[model samples]
Target: MLFELIKLGVDAFSSWNSNRSEIKKIKLENKKELVQLDHELKVAKAQSQIRMAEQDQAQTYNLDMQTTIDMAKTYKDEFILIIFYIPMIMAFIGYQDEVLKAFKSLDLMPDWYILIIVLLAVSISGMRGLFKQALELIGSKFNLKGK
Candidate 1:
């Protein structure tokens, strides 16, 4: 009976050791998983911060552009209008011959030079889409062989 009790005690100790080892291994696996999750969370946070910074930069750029446009709005159009009217005033003031000569001289310039002037005028006038339409019209007219 004593031998049987000794054998039972030994079996119990063996079972306990095995269970303890299994628990330790499970705890190690859990620790590794937690470390991986921590790394992923840090990476996600960094990416989010980067995106927020980019958005802030974009907003600042847009605000600056809006402010500049607003400031220019006060005098840009008026100045352009007055400059354009100067030619008309000169024509009315008995300088029609000079104005005609100036325009005729411009006709002698290169097509590219004329295109540049037109583009500059269109941009200053804030005439969006007109440049493209003008190009298309000019292209179509030039392409016509007879009609």
Candidate 2:
């Protein structure tokens, strides 16, 4: 009877040890999984932040570009006005024939070149609205907003 009791006690101790070891293993696996999940969450958050930052940078760049264009608009207008005024000033000073000849010489240019020059002049003079109204088909595709 004593030997049987000893065997029973031994079996119980063995079972307890085995259960403890299994519990420890399960706890370790759970901890590893929790750590991996935490890492993934952090990485996802970081990637989201990066995307937001990129969008912010793009917006800033676009604003800066627009500001630069706005700042140059006045200078561009003045420069083009001065160019147009030169011929008139010369004509007033008795250079009408030369001015006429120069204008006639422009006719020698290709039609495409003349068209481009005309468009440039109209655009620079801020006459886009009038041009758009006059040419509905072209205006539909042209995105020039005159101020």
Candidate 3:
């Protein structure tokens, strides 16, 4: 009877040991899966943050571009008024004749003076057009808000 009891005890202990080992293996697998899940979550969170930052940067850049476009348009309008309207007003008021006569009395050659005037007018007009084109190019490149 004593021998039988000893054998039963040994068998029970072996079975318990086997169950404990299986439990340990299951727990290890769960821990590994949990770690993997945690890592994936961290990566997802980081990607989201990066996307948010990029979006914010894009918004800031767009705002800056819009502001630049607005400023350029304002400057263009003001310059146009100064360059064309002011001259028109002076001519309408009959000040152009006096001004031309005063400049003519300076003993300058008529041909050279005319050439100089033509050149200056052409240059000013060309520069104004070029500035407008440059502003348009910049607006297009930067996605600026403008008409």
Predicted model with the maximum lDDT: 2
Tens digits of per-residue lDDT, candidate 2, 1-147, equal 999999999999999999999999999999999999999999999999999988966765665556457746468767878888999999999999999999899878899998898788876555655554567655555844441
Q: RMSD for all candidates, in order, please.
A: 13.3, 12.8, 15.7
Candidate 3 local lDDT, 29-49, one digit each (tens): 999999999999999999999
> Between 1 and 2, whose TM-score is larger?
1
Pick the TM-score winner. Answer: 1
Q: Would you list the rank order by lDDT, best first?
A: 2, 1, 3
Q: Per-residue error at 38 for model 1, in Å?
A: 0.8
Can you write out model 1's per-residue Cα lDDT over 1-147, one digit (the tens) per residue? 999999999999999999999999999999999999999999999999999988966765665556458647577667768877887899999999998998899899999999887666666665534555576688798995346
lDDT-better candidate, 1 vs 3: 1
TM-score, each model?
0.49, 0.46, 0.47
Tell me the spans in candidate 3 whose CA falls farther than 4 Å from its real position. Answer: 75-147
Displacement of residue 47 (Cα, Å) in model 2 is 1.2
Error of 3 at 111 (Å): 62
What lDDT score goes with residue 95 in model 2? Answer: 99
Task: Estimate the overall C-alpha local distance difference test score of candidate 3.
Answer: 0.71
- Specify the poorest-scoring 10-residue window by lDDT in model 1: 124-133
